[model samples]
Target: MADRLVPSISLKDFENRKGEITKQLLDAAETAGFLTLVDHGITVDEIEKQFALSKAFFDLPAKVKSKTPHDTKSNNGWEYKAQLRPSTGTYDQKESLWLQRGSQWPSDEDVPHFKDTTTEFLDKCAKVSNQVLSCLAIALNLPDDHFRVANDPNKPDCLTQLRLIHYPASENAVGTWRAGSHTDIGILTLLFQREGEDGLEICPGRESHSSFAMGDVFTPLPAHTGPIVVNIGDMLMAWSDDRLKSNFHRVRAKDVGKSPSRYSIAYFNQGRRDFVLQGPLKKYPPVTVEEYFNQAVQRNFARQQAATA
Candidate 1:
């Protein structure tokens, strides 16, 4: 544990001098791919409400929860156990509900406006995301509104995935076990851990001259309340001219009896499909959406093979 350098920012600090703190955050992002945010302005009561609602949704009967089965192509809606990308050699052993911006809500007379609560949550998240994007622009030495153009309000194509994840307690779990060793594929990821059992490990890079035997160091990040964990994603890394790194992370199964089960909600903010994902500055060559998508698919497949082997 080389003094796991996770930057924790207070929301009050962000509100008082956003410009200064924004620069600091960007600097941290360039070095460490993750940061824990405090005083984020989102109330604890709100978090509790959302967590309760999520638990209720996931607690529904199998038939009800299965109504919206996981769609591989769309990558939207509920995903039952063993349906997601495998974590290491085993299944993720979690259930999740994926919600995208502007998606059609389920329509049943009794359950009318069933998605209202989720929609409200999305609105708040979007506000926070926009603020973060502004900070990112300033951090990259660009105008505050540079990335704002990427989001279209009227016909928005930005994909915002709200995933509710539940990782059960396991008796045979190893020390470093995880859902999988992977990296995110979007611009940025906003993670709200409603409850965590202390198995989330982030692998930091080793010294430049370190030997392969030394291995990349891994640091465990325990969950804290009222702080939203933000991680840089592949798209942002590419857009930043590789200045910011997208981190590699994994979630270990909780120890049986030692800790309670885990639950989290991750909101992935993605760029529009038509947005040409060229490097932010003029120094780097232009890259198209198609090219980026192809590379992501290739990388995902390679990882899958490696995991299986």
Candidate 2:
């Protein structure tokens, strides 16, 4: 099989040809499961600013960075390579700082404009995410704004996560990988990665098929700086009654010579924690978003308990 490119969707066309765009989006969701978003209200300069802020935050002294340790229950703040992969039995070789809207942050004593810039980008991203969700709802034959009620920006339980991740170069690059194969557990994910760093790979059409089956082709998703790579997550997959896919993906560790590191930001658009999520087809049992997230987080870090203990 040959490598493939994820389909592209124009946010600009969505309003004009909503029906057509919804059809295209549905087809892409069913087949490719991932798509590149263009003209999504965020500018290249704005993205660059966020990237610079992330670099500055990561560059802070470990002591200063550690001031905002991640709260396990709330899933906020910084976590340094703590995500353990169930498939590979090893932790990811990266550090991540998670943010929520209106959340507290370390004072700009270390990096100027870090808070303002991040908040701005996150808010813009949220607007873009809501547009995508509306398209998905239209594709699913629900009211155009059906999903919006569950992901409303003002609701306390409708929390979203903005994660800044840095994957440093490793000595044993061949033996160690950055992130092992796994599926995202949220409603949707919008990922912005630094240009020119190659490692992200996606196995399209894996969700509806058997997980253990061989011959699944893994395609390296384009890592260009311009477009945001958007993918369906488990929650949406379940809500669609296995219609939309949440494919398995991984990032291979870079060779010692390619680049010193790679940085990416992922904004996970989750549902209201208090809302009970159920598909229109009702193929699965209803589950509260909070329970689902808590379980997924626990499983991701389960094997690392002894080491930390």
Candidate 3:
């Protein structure tokens, strides 16, 4: 396993030091394809409260939790640990609750302050996402808000997702991993993880390589109390004409025994479904977000069904 840490970028520098920070951001994006965000406006208290609400929601009885089930058409609500990752040809050992802006949601009567806490956190994530997008735009010599507006979450067709995922400890995890190795399908991902637990692993520069093998050389993302780990996704890589990377990553059970289930919050900032994914460089053919998303989903479902059969 290669012991490498994702580079950390300071959000505070976005205003006072644009050129310097743009270079730093570009360097990390091109090489490691991942970065840690620090001095971001989001506070520790806000994150904690949001996590509390998520825990409360996940703790509800199975019958009650079923009130809101995952719908492929809507792409929001809760899904059991049945996500099949085609990259590894296996299912993930985690359950996830997905949320989108303006999507119809179950009443928050059971979880105290659920609506308010999550609303604040999602807003903060959007703000940070825009800030990072601006830096990326400048690095690419495009307008500061070029990519920002391109991936506006408020757009009716855009699918900006906030997911709260829970991974339960299992006795039989040798063949099935927490999350099969795969790259995210969107623009960027801002992930918050519980402290002191290790599971997230990244295979740097794999996007440019050929072999699909889950390489033994993996770098685990360590858990910290603050600082969201930001990683570029496939859409952003395409927007940058392949200059940026969308590295493959997975979650493994770091501790086999005496380990509790893991929880993570992931915010996926994606382009509008109808928008073309081409940019100035034009290194790749233009593809609509909906086309890409639907193909990916179908591939996953097929792989999952085959494995079970």
Candidate 4:
């Protein structure tokens, strides 16, 4: 794997350091399309607590998890090895629990503090996302609230999502990818990985490269405590007149033998269903969030796994 430097930004004094932060963010968005954040308000204890809760939930019996089986229409609940990516042309080897505002959550008895802790964490994620989006807005010479207003999760029929995914320990099978190379559909994706669990990879030349072979070059992003990794996605790429790039990324086990199990928390910031999406420069035609979502789903169906186990 080629070693590419993914910039790290400090949100310690976000308000006072807009000039510095905005420069860092603009460079990252245009080139790397990925960055790490520190001092973003959420603490190490909070992150670890969420990891524990996720482990508890994933440890439940398959039948129990089936109570909230993944729905293709609404996109909530549990799914196993069902994420088929166009890049890999096969399923991603993992299970995930999607959490939305109205998502079916496990009881406190099933996973103590699952709902409460996650809801709290989700709000924190939103605040951090907005901070970054505000910088991007400034980079484009738009109002700071431009992206925030369109992506408010509290709005009705919003599609914002938080996913708790588990990659069970398994053989490092040849020609298999934990997550295939692909770009996110939403505006931004904030990923929280458990300490010491590392497997994410991001490719370079994202804005120019339209096709990738299995042997394409990539950079591996390691996980650690107290830092949240952020990736710009297709939504921002289009909204920025292709000036801001959304890169392709994947997850691959670093071990060549029996890979260890991995856990990750991902928050997707989506535009509200009723919001109209059109770049200020008219680079792309205007389309409502509802219309964009329907088209995206048809192009890339969220194939639910046959079984939970």
The number of the candidate with the highest lDDT is 4
Which model, 2 or 4, shows the larger TM-score?
4
lDDT of 1: 0.68
Give me candidate 2's TM-score against the actual structure: 0.90
Residue pairs in collision within model 2: none
Instruction: Quote model 1's TM-score.
Output: 0.86
lDDT of 1 by residue, 41-155 (tens): 7777877667777777766787777776677766787876654343465566677888676654433332434577667777777777777888887788877876666653324
Q: Provide C-alpha RMSD values for all models, in order.
A: 3.8, 2.9, 2.4, 3.6
Q: Give per-residue CA lDDT, model 2, range 24-137, as digits (tens).
A: 778878877788888888999999899998899998998999888888767798899887777677888899998887565766888798888887897888888888889899
Off by over 4 Å in 4: 1-4, 208-215, 301-309
Q: Residue 276, candidate 4: how far off, in angstroms?
A: 1.2
1-309, model 3: which lDDT tens digit per residue? Answer: 232447887878568877777888898889888888889988888877777777888888877777877887877888887687766676688888888887755567867777777888888999999988898998888888887777898888788899998887666665346898888878999999878766888887655321234456777788776789899987788778878878889888755464467888999998788877776788767788787677666665776677667
- Residues 61-82 of candidate 4 have per-residue lDDT tens digits of 9998888789987888999998
Which residue runs does candidate 2 get wrong by more than 4 Å? Answer: 1-5, 208-216, 255-259, 295-309
Q: What does the lDDT come to for candidate 2?
A: 0.79
Worst 10 residues of 4 by lDDT: 300-309
TM-score of each: 0.86, 0.90, 0.92, 0.92
Steric overlap count per candidate: 1, 0, 0, 0
